[model samples]
Target: MNYKQIVQYGVLIFGAIILIGLVLKGNISHEKFDSEKWKNWTETESELSLRWDMMNSLRNNHELIGKTRTEIIELLGKPDSETKMDFRYYLGMSKHGINTGSLTIKFNENRIVTDFSVWQG
Candidate 1:
C-alpha cells in the first residue's frame, strides 16, 4: 500500500479506538424523570409548616383535654416514653428547657384518650 493510504488507515483506527474508549468509560443511557413525581416533594414542605404551626399553638396554650389523641400526636410529634399502669396508659413527653414543660396523656380501656395534662419541670 502507499504511505498516504497507510497513514489514512492509521488515523481512522486511532479515531475508532478513541471513540470506543470514551463509550466504555461512560455508558450513557437515557433516564426518565417524571416532573409530577418531582413536584410531589413540595407537599412535604406544606406538611412540615402545618406541624410547626400546630406545635406553636400547643406551646402557647398547654391545655391537653378536649383535644383528640390524633391532635396530640400532630402537635407533640411523638411521646418520649409510654407506660401502662394498672388502669390507665401513660404517655410522657420529656422536659426540654426552662420555658418548655412535659406532657402526659392517659388512654382508656379501648385505647381512646380519656385525659391529658401538661406539667412544669
Candidate 2:
C-alpha cells in the first residue's frame, strides 16, 4: 500500500510482538518461581537430621541404654564392672527412679549393637 499504511502496519505488528513476548515471559517466570519454591520445600524436608540422645539423659540419672561404652563413661562417670555374653553386651541399669531397666545390645562382631532389648525391673 502507501508508505503511511505500511508504517502503521509495522508499528502495530511490533506492538503485538512486544505484548506477546511480555505475556510469555511472565508465564515462564511464574512457572519457574513455583518450581523453585517446590524444589526448596522438598530439599528442606530431606535435609533434617534428628538424633535422639537417650543415653545422655539416662546417664545423668541412674538408667540409660543403647549408648556406646564411651557415652556410658561420659554419662555415668564409671561402671562397676563389665560383662560379655555369647550374643550381646550388657549395660546394667541401676535404680534411679520408679523405672528400673537394663539395656541389652546384641553384637555381631567386636562390640557393635545389631539388636537390642530393654528389660524393666
Q: Which ten residues in a row have the lowest lDDT in candidate 1?
A: 85-94
lDDT of each: 0.45, 0.40
Candidate 1 Cα RMSD after full superposition onto the native fold (Å) = 22.2
TM-score of each: 0.32, 0.26
Q: In order, how many clashes per candidate?
A: 0, 0
Q: Residue by residue across 45-117, what tens digits does model 2's lDDT show?
A: 2322111113333324433344555543454333333555212222222223343344454444455334545
Model 2 spans with C-alpha error above 4 angstroms: 29-121
> How many residue pairs in model 2 have overlapping backbones?
0
Residue ranges of candidate 1 with Cα displaced over 4 Å: 1-56, 59-71, 85-100
